[model samples]
Target chain A: MRSRTEKTLIYALLIAGTVTFLFPLWWMVAVSLKTPEAAQAATVRGGIASLVPTDPQWHNYPDALMQMGSVRWTGFLDALANSVVVTILATAGTALSSSLVGMAFARMRFRGSRPMFLVMLGTMMLPAQVTMIPLFILFRNLGWIDTFLPLVVPAFFGNAFFIFMYRQFIAQIPEALLEAARLDGQGWFGIWWRVILPLTRPVTAITAVFTFIFTWNDFLAPLIYLQSDDQATLSVALNSFRNQYGGITKVNLLMAASLTTMVPCILLFLAAQKQFIEGLGKGAVKG
Target chain B: MATIELNCVSKTYTGDVRAVREATLAFRDGEFIVLVGPSGCGKSTLLRMIAGLEAISGGTVAIGGRVVNELPPKDRDVAMVFQNYALYPHMTVEKNMAFGLLRRRKHGGISGLLFHRAERRAELAAIDRKVLDTARTLGIEPLLARLPRALSGGQRQRVALGRALVREPQVFLFDEPLSNLDARLRIEMRAEIRELHRRTKASMVYVTHDQEEAMTLADRMVVMKFGVVQQFGTPGECYARPANRFVAGFVGTPVMNFIEGRVDGGAFVAADMRVTLPAARWPRMPAGPATLGVRPDQLRVLYRADAGASSTAADGASVAATVRSIERLGDRMDVAVMIGGTRMTARIENDDRLVEGGSVLVHIGLGAAHLFASGEDGARLGDAHDAG
Candidate 1:
């Protein structure tokens, strides 16, 4: 009986916490449906009235899309397309390159492998901002500025954090399995492709989802490298939209555009939530 | 079908960790040889060297008369079943068994590409047939479609065995394959493995720490310690005539007992006990300190009064002892007896209801005694046939 009451109390607390966390999201959607005048007027009422608009203006979506006029290619749709392409390619490159490097580090024995892996992990500790200016100069010298190359090409080399995650997951596989595969006539690459890859689906999903989200939301690199409107990603394009229309009358359009930019990330998290939590929890615990 | 020869093979890790010393061994064609030892004794390391999973540091390993030290595992044409039954977790039993054949190439380059589709299909069908036949032999036909995680320990072990058998390689190496099974299942699988060896007549090398498994399954047993082969012979020969004191103690259940003593005037003497040695039987007997080894089953325990009369009348040696403990094992009783501050176990028929602290006499079977030199190595002194 005591346990039952405790369970009820815990569930009640969890529900209240969920409401507290989700209230802002609910308010964002509600305000996006309100006209600019109504949104401004509702803010005076405070609390619940401030959250829910008196009249829902569904036309605000198209109006917001149009008000942010298309540059040569900086229109909302084109920017969304650029984000999707960059994210998909970068995510694929990161997963493939990171898992391969991680497998070599985890399973192979070589003269300098231990020191090399340690150096690779050390890179994760250095702040990305430390390398920002040098990287910009290097890409500029390579004639890769104002192109997607600066944003996507580096992922093919590998990411230290994702490589570390893959190494942790791959190292847990039984050595006997590798030996068995060897006896069954598999070479190193064959074992990696067939045996190691299939078993590491959870870690791969986690890496891919994380890379997608990171690349999709990354504004700083795109802002620095992409000078033309045609190459601007969603994050940079959205910021440009805000700068162009900073008046009080355009607040509803801003809210609508912000909500549009966040939908893909939210859907991705929902789709792969279980794998994400499992991969992160297991990697830390095992390491 | 193949003879495996290891010519002074050795394995040394970095930091000078010698896992296997210069070990020379030869396994005959179609023979079942078991490498039995305690943990860290290099039995598994030796097997891996033969399977090409481990590098041979000092010597050459030849399978079917070809030196395999430089060859990769696939080119070596050997299969190994690991202790954990390392089945591919993602594949079904059928695919697991057929994996090796699918990966192998029958022809190379342009010729291979010309007939690739037809040859590949034929190879797949042949692999399926071989896998099905092996699964049938192991009685796992119904489980061919299921993954390894769904199977029980015994079933998984059978599938692992089938995986090795499906390849039909020249040599089969098993590294403690049944160590993970329950007691009853271990015994059951032991018989199946021996039967499989008999049917296949393939040269097999098995490694285990279980002496019973070694004794029952091996045509010849290699007893090792500290990366060195102490003795290699038939199980009966090793049991009857161990090369050193280590083998004598390692290869038996209810281990052999040792008593330190000195030889004086053609008689062995300890603290308060003496046994007259027959001069005619042991002609080269040196007069010095020695160790006497006796199996538990060779010592007969009798009641105090009967022991007193038998000692005076008997032609064998007998010692007065007090029973320290009595363990009734259904058909047999193992009685721990103390003789002159030394403890020794005597296996007797359970018909006698002996109790703890009871007075008894332990008769040493004169012909069953083993004499070892009283030194650090404790080398055997007489021919094993003399023990009879």
Candidate 2:
């Protein structure tokens, strides 16, 4: 009797929490389908009406894509393409280089290897802002300023955190496997390619997903490096969209654009959700 | 097949931690040598050094009369079967066996790329044939398409063995390859490995802590302790004439028993009784405290009409002991007897109806007895054969 009441109360609290967390996403979607005036009016309703607009403004998506006048070339499509190219290249570079560097650190036995790994780990502790100025100067001297090189080239060098994560994952692989490969006449590079890479698919997926999300959502680097409207990524273009149209009338288009920008990340997470969770769990335990 | 020779090989980890001490040994062509010892005895380390899987800190390891201390494991012309089998989980059994062959060729950069695809395909087909042939030989042809995780422990072990065998290397190194299998499977695999060795005639070094396995499989056995080689000899020689107390205790099933006593007036004097030394041993026997080592089978147990009669015998050759326990092992029984303050086991025929707490006359086979100097390092003074 009393347990029944307690269960009811617990379920009620859970439902309330779920609604509270999901309300923003629900409102964003609903408002994206509303006209500017209706969205502004729905926000005043403060309840169900705000979460579900009465008459959906389906033209807001097409309008946001075409009417974002500050964008160059084919407007939002060009920005999306730019974002895709940069994110894919940068993510690929990060995944490949991080895994190779990680395998070397975890398996190779060279003098100063330990200290060098420690230094690499120490770089993770240092904030990206600390190296931001120096990196800018270096890129500028290389004549790579106002180009995608500044955003994508650094990824090829490897990320300290991802390398550390990959190293931990690779370290958990039995040393016997490496020894077996060596006895099978595989050099270090061959072992890394043929043996280690195939076995680390889950970890590579985790790295790729995280790198894709990071590069896709990153606004600061794109803001600094991408100067022309033509080279601007979706993130930079979206930020510029907010700045250029900071009026109440353009709110619906902004919400629609934001929703469009987040769909790929959301879809990717959902697609690789199983591997992502498994990789995270494995990393937490082994690392 | 090749003769592998290790000359004063040693392994010292960072901070001067010695895993394998300066040890010298050699494996002749087509010989099955087993390195048997307890864990941390450096047997595995020694085998790895020979395989070129480990860096030799000091001396040289020569394979096929060529020094390979600086060579990588791939270049050493040797294959190793690890304790855990170490099968590539991502690969099927056929691919696992063919992997070594595929990587054996060294292709140069640009010029290699031109003809690489055609050559690689031909080589791969040849490797596949070799893999299938080896699989057929091991009776694992059906399992060739299966991944390692899908196979049973024994099947995986067979695949691991197949992988090593497919290489046809100069030497084969097995580091406790059967340690993971069940008792029955281990026994079956033992015979399989021995038969394989006979057929291939490849020089092999097998490592295991199981003395029984070592005794049955080895043409010659190395008994080690504390990273040192205590004895290296044939099984019969090691069991009959051990180099030290350690070797004697390590090589046998029911361990050799050691009783502390003093050598006085051509007799071994203990607190409870005295043992008369054989006439031949007395000439060389030094007058000092010593340990009398005897195997369970070497001690003779005699039924006594009166329990106290042997205890008070004038000659004092036999000791009176009370039967503490009996482990009946089919045709034989291990009878634990309490002789004075010391407890020793005696292996006798199960025909006798011996009960606990019953007194008996225990005679030490002096002709087969082993004597060692009584100290921390119990160096062997003489063996039973010394009597002659």
Candidate 3:
């Protein structure tokens, strides 16, 4: 009876924490479905009417989507396209390049390899803030001031943290597998492509998902680099929903646009959640 | 089939730690040579060096009269089966077995690959046929579509073999492939491997730490210890006429009994025990300190000294000892006895009179004993058959 009561209390606390965490998402959906007056009223001092929509405005989605694009700037549609391109390319670049570099550091034996790996890991200690201005200067010199190359191209060079993760993950795979591949007529690159890369599916999924979410939701980089409104990502364009006075013009429209921006990240996390958890412990024992 | 000749090969890591010292060996064509030793004995390292998976630190390895010191593993035309059955985990059995052939195939060049696609298609079909044939030979054809994770241990072992067989490389290197299986499966796979060796007619270099596995599989085995080859001979020769005390003790079951004592005049004596050597076994003895080794089968543990005279070895060499333990094996038993504070075991028939704490007479079969020079790593002095 004591254990049962403890389990019930534990479950009750978990449910409370879960509801607290999910409240904003529920509010976002509620505001997106509310009428314009109701959404505007929600912006005012704590109004209970904003909690639930009395009369749901289903047309608010299309009305808000139409407000995204205008003559002065390419609006929401263009921002969505820009985010898609950047996210997909950056995720691909991060996954492939990071795993390749990781495989080299993990499996190959060269002179000073240990020190090289240490130096690579040491790069992770440097904050992105330290390199942001230098990178901006470099990208400006490369004629990349308003282009997506500033955001997408750096991913191809590999992330230090992701490479460190891949290196550690690849290191635990049996040495005999690589040796067997070598004896079976596989060159170093061939062995990595054929054997090492194949066993890293779970890790690859986790890396790809994280890269997708980071590239999609990134606001500061896009705001800094994307000069034209046409090339702006969804994260930066989400700011356009408000008027010049910093008060939302259509509170429901802003909620709708913001909710749309978060959908891909949520779906991606849902899709990769299984692989993310499996990747933590699966590589240690599986073939 | 290829003949492998290793001339004084040695491996030394940094800080002057030697893993394999100057080792000279020669394997005949189509011979199954097994390198057997305890763990950390450098047997697997030697096998890897032969397969070109490891760089040779010193000397040269010549396969079929061609030196492979500078060649990479792919260029050396050798295949290895690892201990863990290192199958490409994501690939099906068919793709795993065909991987080597796929990598080694050439399509003339980039332009030929585009212009002559028919040739590449034919090559792919031929590789598929080869994979199927090898899988059928190993009786894993039905599992061609299944991933390695779906197979049983024995089936995975067969797939590992099939992967090597499909390549048809010049030489086969196996690094303790059956070490992971259970006892009964190990025995079953041992026979199957011997059968596979016979059918393939390929020269195989097998490495194992298990002495029994090495003895049963090897045409001629290389016994190693402490990075050095202790002895390299046929299993019969290693068992019957061991080159030194270590080789004698390592290659037998229940272990060979060693009595560290001195041979004074004609008999072996240590502490309070002395066994009179027969004149025929040791006539002209010139020995100081020596270690005597006797096979368990050669010694007889008699219940009574008077009754032992008629049944035991001729020349009547017997010592009084208390029975420490008797392990029964139905028809035969392992009787461990304490002879004057020294413990020795003798394999004899399960006699009814033997009991723990009871004293018995242990007859020393000097005619079949091995006399070695004193101290560890000692040279064998002489055998009973040849010394007299």
Chain B TM-score, all predictions listed: 0.94, 0.93, 0.94
Q: DockQ of each candidate's interface versus the true one?
A: 0.49, 0.55, 0.70
Model 2 misplaced regions, further than 4 Å: A1-11, A36-50, A68-73, A109-118, A240-249, A283-287, B106-116, B280-283, B310-317, B382-388
Per-residue lDDT of model 2, residues A1-287, tens digit only: 56988999999999999999987888888988987877777766656747767788888888887765374327687788999999999999998899999999989888999999999999988988998899889988999988899989889999999899889888888889889999998888899999988888788889999999999999999888778888888887776546535744567787888888899999999998998888877743210
Q: What's the count of clashing pairs in each model shown?
A: 0, 0, 1
lDDT of 3 by residue, A1-287 (tens): 56988999999999999999988888888899988877877867546556787788888887777787564234877998999999999999998889999999988888998898889889999988998999899999999989999999989989888898888899999888888888777777878777877788788888899899899999999988889989889888888887789977888988888887888998988988898889876758466
Question: Which residue runs does candidate 1 get wrong by more than 4 Å?
Answer: A1-16, A36-50, A62-77, A243-249, A283-287, B105-115, B278-281, B304-315, B384-388
Q: Interface RMSD for candidate number 2? A: 3.4
lDDT of 1 by residue, B1-388 (tens): 7999999999998898998999998889999999999999999999999999988889999999999999999889999998988899989999898888778758433566686868766776788899999999999999999999899999999999999999999999999999999999999999999999999999999999999999999999999999999889999988988887888888887888888898778777787577777665556677899888889998888775654432422335788888999888999988999988999988889846577987778887756677778864587777536567
lDDT of 1 by residue, A1-287 (tens): 56988999999999999999998888878878887777766555546766766678888877776655365323777788888999999999999999999999989998999899999989988999999989999999999999999889999999998898889888898899999999988999989888988888888888889899999999898899988776778887766545545744566777787788888998998998988787767743110
Model 2, position A57, has a per-residue lDDT of 87
Q: Is candidate 2 or candidate 3 better by DockQ?
A: 3
**lDDT at residue B259 of model 1 (Cα atoms):** 85
Candidate 2, residue A171: how far the Cα is off, in Å: 2.8
**Model 3, span B2-76: residue lDDT tens:** 999999999988899898999999999999999999899999989989988777899999999899999988888
lDDT of 2 by residue, B254-275 (tens): 8887898998887788878777
